[model samples]
Target: MLITQCQQADVALLEEHLPSPSRTSFHAQRFARQGVGTSTYLVAWLADRPVANAEIRWNGCAATEVRQAVPNCPEINGLSVTEPLRGGGIGTALIRHAERLAVERGVQRIGLGVDDDGNPRAAALYARLGYRPVVRYLDRWSYTAHDGEVHDIEDPCVFLAKELTSAPTPDLGVRVQ
Candidate 1:
């Protein structure tokens, strides 16, 4: 599996596979317009087939709970792994990728919101990844569905955060005399 930033070619490929009205397409376009270090779109591929995706937003995000809790921290949003590829560590890789990007930008902390009521497994995963809950609230947002119908979402959510620190350099095990 390979994880990389979405390129122009990747955008076209995402549009073809994911299409608009899906969050994937929306994030891909945002990445194209905003570029890296601001809003980055990442795609996880398995031998050329896109298997998962996530976005790191430096400017801000729609999750009011997370924004209010960590105003200056970058947020990871829209993390999704294809149905058949779930539980294969793709989501973990995407998250780590976002964290690495945040560290590169000198960001000290990162935040994300999970639907606690709807997806307990995801919440568990975040906890296992060292994210601690900071806030709880209802997530309300509106989006146009695939059939061109507007939909309103109001899910109970928990905001989780983790501090980003540089990894310790590996020791070569050489003792100097």
Candidate 2:
């Protein structure tokens, strides 16, 4: 897989693959954030198709607890891989790519939130990637769907953080689509 910053051109591929609210005017929205240096949205491609996505929020998570605890840490949010191809190291590669990008921007740490009660596999993956639990809270957020329907989500989650050093970028040996 080739990991790179998301572009407007990738929107349709993401839509056909993941088909979620994340694509709700997100091409332009992500571009705005990227242009202003506030966020970086990354897309993972396999065979010229988008298979995964992640975002780096340089200001840290918006949640009050996460902001208070790791103020300068960039949070890696909205990570998702296509369901059929998950478990193939695509998610890991995306995360490492995000971390490398963060280090390039002078970030010393990073974070991501996992569903506390429902996702043991994701928690384990984060643990294996050197993230440690730092804050536990009930997170609430809302999103507008592609069809103009708004949805609210609440989840019990733990935010995991990792200290980033100036380590050499790994040769993930990704196979691009």
Candidate 3:
């Protein structure tokens, strides 16, 4: 197994191997482009094929809104391992790789979200990796619903995070949950 920063040439390979959410070409391009200039993504391969992937972002997106609401937080983006290889530690490898990159980039902490019931396994995996849940929210219609009316769903999505390196000047905005 080899872990390396993703390249444009590796995009199609990643698309062919990862599952639905991680397979799109646009994201592959984004990751390859950003990982190069920005150092935000890392891809894991086995036998020369993409098997797992993760992204560590300086900011949070919708999944990380709760943490953003809190204060200071470093947001982590997509983290996934191909379904067929789930129990084999690919996810852990990808996360650890992201951690190394995050630490190198001077980030003090990192955050990510686990989808409601839909991704329970991912939540458990993150917990095993020392991530703690700091916030929870309901997921209404997901990409198309109002926050006010979205409050009733029992979706229970969770935001989890881990402190990477403590900064000399504490950014007391938020602590990873």
Stronger candidate by TM-score (1 vs 3):
1
Clashing pairs in 1: none
Where model 1 places Cα greater than 4 Å from the true spot, the runs are 19-24, 168-177
Q: Compute each candidate's TM-score over C-alphas.
A: 0.83, 0.89, 0.71
**Candidate 3: tens digits of C-alpha lDDT, residues 1-177:** 677766778777876776333223544655754765643666777777877777765655444457555455655666777778888877776676667667767777777778867887888888887789878865343221332332233456777878875432222221111
Q: Candidate 1: deviation at residue 173, Å?
A: 23
RMSD of each: 5.9, 2.3, 8.7
> Per-residue lDDT of 1-177 in model 1, one digit per residue for the tens?
778777767776666665567443575556764564578888877766666778887875566666777788777877888787788777877887788778878888888889878898888889988899998878787777776778787888888889888861222321111
Order of models, best lDDT first: 2, 1, 3
- Candidate closer to the true structure by TM-score (higher is better), 1 or 2: 2
Q: List, residue by residue over 3-90, the lDDT tens digit for candidate 2.
A: 8787777766777776666426555565568778899988888877888888887887888988888788888888888888888888
| Predicted structure with the largest lDDT when compared to the true one | 2
Q: Which is the better candidate, 2 or 3, if ranked by lDDT? A: 2
Off by over 4 Å in 2: 26-28, 145-149, 175-177
List where candidate 3 sits over 4 angstroms from the true fold. Answer: 19-26, 32-39, 70-72, 138-156, 166-177
